[model samples]
Target: MKNIIITGTSRGIGFEMVKLFAEAGHNVLALSRNSKPISDLNLKNVSALSFDISDESEIVKLGGYLQTAMKKVDILINNAGYLVSKSFSELSSQEFKECYIVNVLGPATLMRTVLPFMKKDGHVVNISSMGGVQGSVKFPGLSAYSSSKGAILTLTELLAEEYKESGPSFNALAIGSVQTEMLEEAFPGLKAPLLPIEMAEYIMDFSLTGNKFYNGKILQVSSTTP
Candidate 1:
């Protein structure tokens, strides 16, 4: 079984993904600021850690854990996110920093720290948003969130190129609206075509098998108009 690491596992798709991987007999490291939800599951193959992606010290702590426990990582899924529905004019500098820290910097730092533990054939899947895609339909209140996600999309491509000849593949998924808490927070009363668990299932499959066929690629996963 592969040694897998997933971020933002306290709820939503990330939470569902932990269970999926563990049930499939894979060793899972579930990371979240609030680890109680996963810890309560008590899954045999899953280790739940209270992780703050924005903290450099936490990343260092995780690296030590990897060295001692999970000698190698087969998959790393950057599924954690931060968002706020505020107009561009209303978004404060601190708010923007918070969004970027979680959506871009955190993932980038995590990948750098985890690369040494991943094999050449391993996969790194970044969870982006449809709003982040260039030329896609845009929204007014997501300036900070969507722009940060866009940054991650570019980061994924650059990393894939840098490691193309040496190691693990990197890919980003620009997913459309899903019935997640984040969605409700951003666009209340809006009904999405997909559910958190449904998206989790798809993401789980891609994290395992998509690397062979795709790297430095942004897959737009949406059924609605572009």
Candidate 2:
């Protein structure tokens, strides 16, 4: 079984992923701002932590924990994301910062912190948004959220190239709308075609095998736009 680390596990896709991976006999480290949701599951193969990805100290702590506990990581899924839907003219600088911190900076930092614990066959899966893909349909209120995701797409490619010869492969998934709490909060009344569990299953499978077929590539997984 592989040792997998998944972020944003308090709810939605992350939550489902934790269950799926553990049920499949993998060791899972579930991280989120609120750990109770996963903690209550009581899965033997799963360990949950209240992690704030935007905090540098927390990231450092995570690195230490992996060094001592896991020793090596097989899969790292950067799934946590932040979004704020507001008119461009009314968007605050702080709002933009918050978006980038959670969506871009946090995941980028996480990859760096986890790199030392990964092997050549390891995989780093970055969860992105369809809105971030250039030429894809764009929405007005997501300037900050979409742009931050776009940054992750480029960062994935650059990192993959930088470490091509040494080891772990990096790739991104530009996903579409899903029926999630974050979706309801950001765009009320809009129904998404996909469910969180469905997406999580795809990611779980990819995290295990995608590295063999692709690297530094952004796979657009969407049938609808936000």
Estimate the TM-score of every prediction: 0.98, 0.98
lDDT of 2 by residue, 113-190 (tens): 999999899999999999899999899899999999999999999999999998799999999999999999999999
- Looking at model 2, the pairs that clash are none
* Superposed Cα deviation of residue 220, candidate 1 (Å): 0.4
Clashes of each: 0, 0
For candidate 2, which ten residues in a row score worst on lDDT?
217-226
Backbone clash total, candidate 2? 0
lDDT of 1 by residue, 124-148 (tens): 9999999999999998889999999
Deviation from native of the Cα of residue 88 in model 2, angstroms: 1.0
Clashing pairs in 1: none
